[model samples]
Target: MASNFSRQEPWNLSQENLQEWFQDNVEEGSRSFAVESNKSMDDLVRFLHNMPDMKTKGPKAKPVKVKEVRKGGSIEKGTFYKDGSDLDCVVVLNGIPKLKANTKTGKYRRGHLKPLVEKVVTALQQASFTARCEKVSNLQLKVYAKQETGGILEIDILFTGNNLDYNYIDDEVTMQRILSTPYNTMLNMPPKSQRFIYQPCLTPLQTEFVKSQPGNVKSLIRLVKYWKAEYLHQRQTEKLINSYTLELITIYVYEEEMGSPDRFDLGEGFKRVLSLLAYKLGGFQHYWDNFYSDETAQRGMKLKDMMKRPILLDPADPSDNVLQRWKKGLGTISEIARETLQTPLLRSIHVN
Candidate 1:
């Protein structure tokens, strides 16, 4: 394992106090937030499942199934930001009407995708917990709700089965197999296409990859996410950075710069990641072979916007650059990173 602490000045605190600070601030705070938010997520999941629009009435009718709220929102990742936390929930709609089969091609016409997503939106708007429906997309709907404790909760309900009739319930295995397929075979088109067509199908794989990461790495990720949230609050600017971008960078720092996730000083480890951001860490790209290949990642890398300074490849979907949207804000983020280093404790972060 390679370490990057050689040039940095050492902290004055002993190891015991550093560990105590992390536990009180990052770890305990994150767990507490998850506990409260999860109760609301459970209630909301039940409300959505019981909606008339979500019900199926026929011999083939089955109970509506809601996938677990995986990734950052889950307790495992502890990724709640200070001002607001985004919870991602994946739901599979059963007994949805299939598109009219094309007589000429004998393939299912997928024109019903939009209507189904709209249907979901309408149902959620009518649901009791939803304060307002914020945004609706082709595959997901974003809604806002006020927590009983006076916090704001933003939920993104992803209909995994709704993308152009590529229903997961119908053929999951075949769709998932494509994630591991060669990059060229998956997309034969020009490399400039930015659409992550296979994102929905690969959700499970993404969740699992994050879940299986070492515990220490997850802690480091949560700490960086907390810092980024504070960084934005101080500037009071538009939301330029996504939590996922920092999560990947944290992983890179731990794997490449900090030697190993198994052993490290928590405060020093965090400072190292912040230092990387302060310096605009770039040049090398990273990918995991858990779901894709190096050759495939190399090919998929062509689609990313090279003009962007730092490129962090999505672990599950190599063709997508998770950091692309945050490119313009790198300079500000670097400055913020420096400011965070001077503080002994990161503050004003709300978990709810």
Candidate 2:
């Protein structure tokens, strides 16, 4: 593990040696993990992707059918960590009416997603995988399969209406509509529910937002993820910041410090990221304009009343403040970030 290098007087190493250390220790490990995990992960994705459309009864709505299964999360974005990696699958259902907004409050109706989730679970069980359902703001089905290496691979399935028709990547109008529709009307719902409801629909854009970054940027993201997993022990608790938030933060730091340079010092970039988290995370707030302009995003933020500390809006979906759910862990994360910045391995790496 790269953590072993920190104990061996890393601060004494020169800048060139520090870069080499990061390359050999961090980048190589991430590459090796991806190589070793690719085959099994690929097989699972193929299996799910090839599954036939399932016909199942909806509890109250008409009989729904599986419209499509889309890939999401780190697997789709290519920033998965070595220690803990899971697949995020979005199951799009047909025949279910689009989520209706309350005429009075304009908030989208809840409790309608569970039936679709239950059907997805039944389909997974029939396909020879152990499946279970749970509700955390939205409906999710966890499907388990045994890997060839004697480990279990867990895939989280989220159900949504057939809302993937729009080309959100290229169509700004579609992006605006999707983000502004339910989100602008419903500011009073819990943050988690607000984000989770439209997550499946926005998965493609989210994957594209991360996947379209430069290779080096993705490498930096992987490095940050490795650090989070091994040093911060973030995998031990769900309350900690998520990998997506970390990826966006890394991208933000890299872009701010290094700009569009062909090549930059990963060590310096990492130090800057740690510095931000360690010293300035208490009031961290950032968003991107990939799908919408900054002015539009600011309006949406105001509409949503996203005034909390450590706010990071999802680039694909401006309505989502990705870090809202992880507030409880911010103090611990800030403390760890501070300690990590002072570590011998990183203390020598400084940024302007």
Candidate 3:
């Protein structure tokens, strides 16, 4: 006998079918931004690559070497919502001066990293592009992309020091050691704290994780993100939740309820995710150690103490509890899901 789930056809909540709706609206959302952003990114990368370092000594002076340009955030994840206006890029600066060791903390001071990031903003402004340094807890250089119509695009340039120690290795032990190395560290300070410290680096692992997912899985993420946006707008709350947290939650649902991505359905995936949010959201914890070591996984389990509910460990950086501070907003999502599921038309699609 065939399994009922295997025989079920795709269902859509809207008047038009789900596939058609996605083809007409959701999938088409990122096209314009993708094209315009690509041109600006290329121009900026070229400028950054060719810019000379004035501080270099006379005879041996050479242009700065930008080792890598890694794309991050929703845009890179292929889940950017309709009318999304921001793009994130991480540029690794090679040959940065190491920070002096702090005698007090027995660790290196990260004050030097900020100045290095600021120099990026200076170069972009000098290149005659509309760029400026945004003052925040982290060093982010904001460049306004040239746009003929629609809202201006904001490109967030996150600077990270090059980690030559991070070689291409499959060994878990070797990888964990590299992640903990000083070369992979980036400056991170808690809000209203005088104490500045280095946080573990963010590589392209998260990007690749999402990118590796099948197209339907990516569509599932976009659905949750779009719903979250609508939920936040309806509530008019000041507290903002991380989009990455929602993405992980969606991934968890797809893996647990829907099985493999090969046969994943958009409507069914959306139902499982919304069901998780609606029903089992409180005290939820799901993780996998695909990218990190078992020891890192054990260490990450302790970080759950800080999280309220719906705990999720960031796949790349274990120290980050992606859903730590999303308590009230999550409740709103749960309530919204419950109410939406109660609708007569959506009930059959959402229910098991």
Per-residue accuracy of model 3 over 124-202 as CA lDDT, tens digit each: 7666545444534344677775555544567777665544345546565676677654422321322222222222236
Better of 1 and 2 by lDDT: 2
- State candidate 2's TM-score: 0.81
lDDT order of candidates, best first? 2, 3, 1
Best by TM-score: 2
Using alpha carbons, what is the TM-score of model 3?
Answer: 0.76
Q: Model 3: runs farther than 4 Å from truth?
A: 1-16, 54-66, 97-110, 126-133, 167-200, 237-239, 304-309, 342-345
**Stretches of candidate 1 exceeding 4 Å from the true structure:** 1-16, 51-78, 81-84, 93-110, 162-178, 182-186, 189-194, 304-309, 342-352
What C-alpha lDDT does candidate 1 achieve relative to the native structure?
Answer: 0.57
At residue 125, candidate 2 shows an lDDT of 67
Question: What C-alpha lDDT do the candidate models reach, one value each?
Answer: 0.57, 0.66, 0.59
Name the weakest run of 10 consecutive residues (lDDT summed) in model 1.
Answer: 100-109
TM-score of 1: 0.74
RMSD of each: 8.2, 4.2, 7.2
Model 2, 44-141: lDDT tens digits are 55655665554433454455566666778776787776664546777677765554333221233343456446554555566543433344434576
TM-score of each: 0.74, 0.81, 0.76
Q: How far does residue 198 in candidate 1 sit from its true spot (Å)?
A: 2.4
